[model samples]
Target: MQLGKAVRLERIMNRNNGRTIIVPLDHGVTVGPIYGLVDLRETVNQVAEGGANAMLMHKGIPRCSHRRHGRDIGLIIHLSASTSLSPHPNAKTLVGSVTDAIKLGADAVSVHINLGDETESRMLADLGAICSEANEWGMPVLAMMYARGPKIENEYDPDVVAHCARVGVELGADIVKVNYTGDPKSFVRVVEGCCVPVVIAGGPKLENELDLVRMVHDSVQAGGAGLSVGRNIFQHPNPVKIVAALHKVVHEDWDIDAAMELL
Candidate 1:
């Protein structure tokens, strides 16, 4: 690995455990400035204070959330975007570049790809190009891959999830994020199939906190790197406590019970 990329990866992943707890705050582009995201500084600070490994946001947000003091958090500049109001919301387009991320002082850059979307080929092309450009600068690329299309019956199906992860690996992503396959046994297959580290995505807000932590715990047990959760963490009544709990679960290998204590 390039020293530059390795150094930056350490900022977003626990050096000892090789795991991470990333909070995505880029939803403003898709859904607008929703509840948990209206106050960028506070949200960024709360997650950082809670020991989140990194915070992912759109390219334009660093100015709003950059911290001068307190715990430092890794920044991942999201390069792709699509508005929910769009008829083709799943078709993400590259709205930023690796050079832009470097200018923003991002630790990494990420792109979203919906495998089954009508524009799947275009998104893949964008991901391939971004990976090539990022490699030149020794920047890490995180690919958020999902199986969302008309032919898909269940996105969480183990086979489907594994395919999404493998596509990212084949395309040169350093880290791949996909939906969890419901249980550790099935999820393990997804992890085993991918050479690169696989992280689970928090699809939506869970009604029960236990469900959320258990999912993270199980994924780790199945050899997942960690999680890149958005609404589940940021939308919680207390984002700090939830992020802290997740930090323990991911980096410390805490069981659901012990991690839940933080909440």
Candidate 2:
């Protein structure tokens, strides 16, 4: 890795633990300003104050959420998006460039790609182009790869998840985010298949907070680098406390029971 990229990764990942907790707040473009997203600065502050390593958002969000004074949190600009209303919502297109993220002072840039979508080729091409540009600038790239297509019967199947993660690494992503395969045993294969760090997405909101924390714990046990969860963390009744608990679990190796005490 380039010195510049290494330096930037340090901002979003715990250098001591090689783990991270990134809260994604870029859902407004995909689902329209949903709850937890309307008050950008406050939400960002709350998450950051709770010790989230980074917050991922669309290019324009920093103008609203970037704090002049507060606990610092790394920024990751999401470069691709697709509205939920779109018939082809699974197909993500690049709406921001690596140059745009750099100008906005981002620590990293992320792109979403649905591996089995009809427009998979286009999204892959976009990812390749973005990776090339990001490499030139020494900007880290996180690829959110999912198996969301007609052929994919179970997106959470370990093999499917592993393949998605490997695609991200093969395409040059610094980190790959995929759905957890439901258990440490299955998820371990997902992590081992990818050369780069692998992280799990929160998926839909879970029924209880413990489930969320347990998922993080299990993923980490499976060798996942950490998490890039969105709704579960930010949309929780107490985002700050949950994040702190996650921090303990991911970075401090706290037991799930101990981490849950923060909630």
**Model 2 poorest 10 in a row by lDDT:** 254-263
Model 1 lDDT tens row, 1-263: 99999999999999887899999999999999899998889998899999999999999899998879889999999999999999999999999999999999999999999999899999999999999999999999999999999888999999999999999999999999999999999999999999988999998789989999999999999999999999998898888899888888888888888987878
Give the 10-residue window scoring lowest on summed lDDT in candidate 1: 254-263
TM-score, candidate 2, is 0.99
In model 1, where do residues sit more than 4 Å from their true spots?
A: none
For model 1, how big is the CA root-mean-square deviation?
A: 0.7
TM-score (C-alpha, index-matched) for candidate 1: 0.99
CA lDDT of each prediction against the hidden true structure: 0.94, 0.94
TM-scores of the candidates in the order shown: 0.99, 0.99
Model 2, 1-263: lDDT tens per residue? 79999999999999888899999999999999899999999999999989999999999999999779999999999999999999999989889999999999999999999999999999999999999999999999999999999899999999999999999999999999999899999998888889888999999989999999999999999899999999998899989999999999999899999997777
As a whole number from 0 to 100, the lDDT of residue 16 in candidate 1 is: 88
Candidate 1 lDDT score relative to the true structure = 0.94
